[model samples]
Target: MPVPTTRDKNPASILIEADKCSGCGLCVNVCKDFGLEIVNNKVHQSDKALFGCIACGHCMMVCPTDVIAIEGRTLSPVLMFELPEKSQAADYESLLAMFKRRRSIREFKNKAVEKEKIEKILEAAQTAPMGIPPSDVHVLVLENKKQVRLFAEDFSNYLKGLRWMSSRWFLALIRPFLKKENNEMMHDFVKPLFDVYVDDMDKGNNWINYDAPLAMYFYGSPYADPADPIIAATYAMLAGESLGLGTCMLGAVHPFIQNGKKASAFRERWGIKYPSREGLVVIFGYPAVHYQKGVKRTFAHIHRVS
Candidate 1:
């Protein structure tokens, strides 16, 4: 027979016999070169991996039955198992430009976010690098506006109950200033966007949470030595941004949920018990107002060591 043209070396040809394949679809997912596809519930060749497969063998390894085989002609292609195309990624200057352009969004649209889009964002949260293995971080998805209102009332009362634990004079002294002061601190810790949101709610209307059609609460065990919900929440927030959704972190709400009565009711209704670890709440929705652009930044100096 003539020299097999398949002998050209990158990923030359993939010989897959369907009869031997269990139709696991693992190969379809593992092939990074866009070299495989599943049709009629079976896997088949989609593209020649000659320039693509990189000969990493991910497909062959994950294959349970050892049916798939990859043939190569030349040097193997580089595998991207650790990170995504960092070699081709932008330089430090370019990244600083992107960070400078980042902005905090306020004012969400009246539109409802699609369930599938929410699911995609959550998938990124699931993929976040965990500090330890086998940690259970729970997500509570609230899509109903009515329920959001209920939670807000419950949340407000929860704060009130905590206030009740103090002296009456102290409560009286702080009552008038609580909303004003809480709003300001909220603006500082969470986001400046909450300044407007809290103002609207103070006007006897549950406006902010009302505006957000979606919210997710994340929680983990409190018994752990170091609670890392905030770290995980940070991942979820970035993941949400990557998926083209607007997110505002609500650091203030965790206190109410963990210790307040209104919070207890909300938790009981949802059948969520306190994790012996850490917890967080993340709110997301389409922005009613697009951020015009990122604001100016404060300067920081970096020290480099040779």
Candidate 2:
């Protein structure tokens, strides 16, 4: 049976042009599912496929000739395009420079990101790899500062209803079920964060999203892998950096808006279609401040297997 997603239930249809096939085996080599094989020196659909055609489009993309057409599961041969030349891609130094110069920017100039730039950011994000084809990631875009601030205000109001979650009684009640680090974080970081988000926004301090000119909340359907939206959001962030826009990832809003009637209502109000296990909100804008130097950072640990 085909893997089910929120969008489609059936597997893709794989059509092969036997007359055009050169039997080069490029498509066969790339298709790990063993969906296609050479028979009598012509490509043919094989019964050995594990999940049928996932509509990954890898076979069609790799074919030397226009021999394969993948249809269904939101994919088609028409969707294929010419790949950009390798020279057009950024070199290691340029990529590292962009990464190093990037930082979490909350202070933004009172300027809106251009519509073209916003579209480009999304286009780049669509190229991100996913756990499955026909990626389940969805994005909610707040196109300007007014919408962003309004969303923050509404979210702050919603947080008011969830203030009980940060209470001492609730913490004590839930502490035993949580791991030590999680328990400490719930008491320390999360509790204070809830208060700060609700309280500060009430006083006209827009820390919820820092009043950025543009914001995109990337999330997935219940059927999606938890990392799908996160990976897409990261791609969007990198795209923002490439476009000279400042960006910041706001993690606090996601967990709060995930599990209850109040949360469901809040989601419905904002057009969020489903409650996913993980999601992220990224704000983008022209930065008000400029950095003089890039800071070096490191991972917690990096140990290769012996």
Candidate 1 residue-wise lDDT, 1-306, digit = tens:
112222232235566777777887998887766778887777788855434554446676677776667666432223213455878876989666645544444456776778787877777676654433233456777775566666766555444445433434654565576787774554354343343335445565664455466777777654322344566666777666656667777655655456545666767777566633456667776666665666665669778899
Cα misplacement distance, residue 25 of candidate 2 (Å): 1.0
Against the reference, the lDDT scores of all candidates come to 0.60, 0.93
What digit string (tens of lDDT, one per residue) describes model 2 on residues 237-305? 999999999999999889888898999999999999999999999999999999999878999999999
Q: Which 10 residues in a row give candidate 1 its minimum summed lDDT?
A: 1-10
lDDT of model 1, residue 136: 46
**Which model scores highest in TM-score?**
2
Alpha-carbon deviation at 188 in model 1, angstroms? 12
